[model samples]
Target: MDGPRTLVVSGASRGIGRHVAMRAQAAGWRVIGLARQTDAGAPFEMRACDVADSAAVRETFRALRGEPRLHGLVNAAGIASMNLLLATPPETMRRLVEVNLLGTMYCCAEMGRLLARRRGGRIVNFSTIAVALGLRGEAAYVAAKSGVEGFSRAFAREMADFAVTVNTIAPGPVETDLIRHVPKGQIDAIVARQVVPRMAEAEDVWQLVAFLLGDAAAMMSGQVLHVGGA
Candidate 1:
């Protein structure tokens, strides 16, 4: 029998990232979860690492060099602030860029290199539908996720030869703390624009993830899939 494939999901402590890690583990992947805190008695093996800190990410992956080969990485670690370009604080903008964009870059660099060496793996980077819709009051958040979308496409090309498919998922707002700060009216408006007119469930996203990480997605790379139903 084949051993369980290993997956690393950053920001696994909460929100969509946590959902992804939990579901993946249930599906038989040996999951290593990364977050700011290492809580006691988590279901999967958890590691504390700040994705925004490149050095920390590097060292964390270095420690994992002795573990099972990493077959997948989910760059789900991100932060967001909803505000107009003028009203948004500089500090909030900086944090959004740092955690959402820079953090994804750091993990991809470290994990991408490792997967390239092995010549096979999968990478899924979280993006937001705001990039396509240009949602108001989310200038910083949209910009940051835009960077993720762009990076995933180019990275996919670079990794294609190694059979490491890189893809980005741009999901509309889900019922997670990630959007808890947004006004209910705002979320309803966004949902109305979707063809399905509803919030995304974790399962909806995971169905896509399962295919991306499986053998079926070998020919699919450099793609941005929208679960937004727009």
Candidate 2:
């Protein structure tokens, strides 16, 4: 059977989300990319909005309601902050939660409603391997990602009877701007910790996301798929 014909990917200006959007477009799906900035190089329709703002997300979805069929949603808009539990400021922590967790909730809530009306769709939420591995300076990030895992599972259960599959992808050490601040030695140490002895590439994570949004992943839902060399 043919898979979904349309896909909506957030954070598509760069990194894994960009890769996913490009790959999905290449595979003949109509792609709509949501990001805070517009990149002239982007190959799909770029919608500028901060997913952290509930009103903006709702307005974007409302504008997209005219489309005949919306099949997939990738919640990839995220913000990363690294700080010790004692050193992290209250506002910083709140910002991380707002962007990584609340933003995801807003996107999922809005998109899930549309998918529910159609009786079928897929949602791929982004989590982090830090949530599982427990890094030293990622207290806020870990907490937010952990929340994302729980949220994805619960939402998946709620959407199951409607044939909407919601899943989370917990990726480890991908080479993106998110890691630009890490020391070279620290980067090497992280790669060594992985069984593959290398960091994941943007495309590496995108492949799994593509699978989840594709027909082959119809049976999978409410699960967190970890993408790491180990």
Candidate 3:
């Protein structure tokens, strides 16, 4: 008598998070979306929660404890700023690390508990190609995402005994609002270095996410998959 298979997606108000929620819903999974700004028109259930706020994330999951079959979590919520290390303000750097790294860690901690109790689940966090390519203008952002990659690797090992798998996806120059403010030349340069010289669409990332959440990826954990060939 298990309930419906469910997924909790953060940053679902827009961008890649919204796309993942939509695709998961269309595929028949029950999706609960978390964001500071809730989307009224989203296909799945939307809740107001900022993953960066540890208390908010905890209360949100406490509210969702009724979902008996929580199958996965996708921590796609993140923020970025393209500024040199010295030029970046302390507040800005802190926000980047808080949202991009700590926020992800918070959600994983809460959801990891639920999934562990269920004895199996999936976790897909987001990193960035900037971390791999050492993109010059985004020092704070790159450092934050690099932390995500490292954290996922360690988390996967800790969660292994419970049959829970943790993985990360690093996308390059995705066509989303996250990159709209970045300079065109910067994006172009990054794309040109990719094996596939094109900005990734949200769908491109979603396909890999779908793989990681499926039975096919049961053996894949603690891996950072780079899309757009970065």
Q: What does candidate 1's lDDT look like per residue over 1-230, in tens digits?
A: 36898999999998888889999999999999999898667788899999989999999987777656679999889888888999988899988999999999899989988898888999999898888889998889999999999999998999998999999999998888989989999999999898778888978988898899898999999899989665
- Model 2 over residues 1-230: C-alpha lDDT tens digits? 45547899999998888888999898888999999997878889899989989999999998888678688999988888877989999999998999899999999999989999989999999998788777788999999999999999999999998899999998888888888897888777766766677778888888898899887999999999888743
lDDT (Cα atoms) of all candidates against the true structure: 0.90, 0.88, 0.94
| Alpha-carbon TM-score of each model against the true structure | 0.97, 0.95, 0.98
Models, CA RMSD each: 1.1, 1.8, 0.9
**Candidate 2 stretches greater than 4 Å from native:** 1-4
Runs of candidate 1 exceeding 4 Å displacement: none
Q: Write the per-residue lDDT of candidate 3 for residues 1-230, one digit (tens) a residue.
A: 65568999999988999999999999888999999988888889999998889999999998888897788999999999998898999999999999999999999999999988989999999999998899998999999999999999999999999999999999999989998988899899999988899988999999999999998999999999999877
User: Of the candidates shown, which would achieve the greatest lDDT relative to the real structure?
Assistant: 3
Cand. 3 Cα-lDDT: 0.94
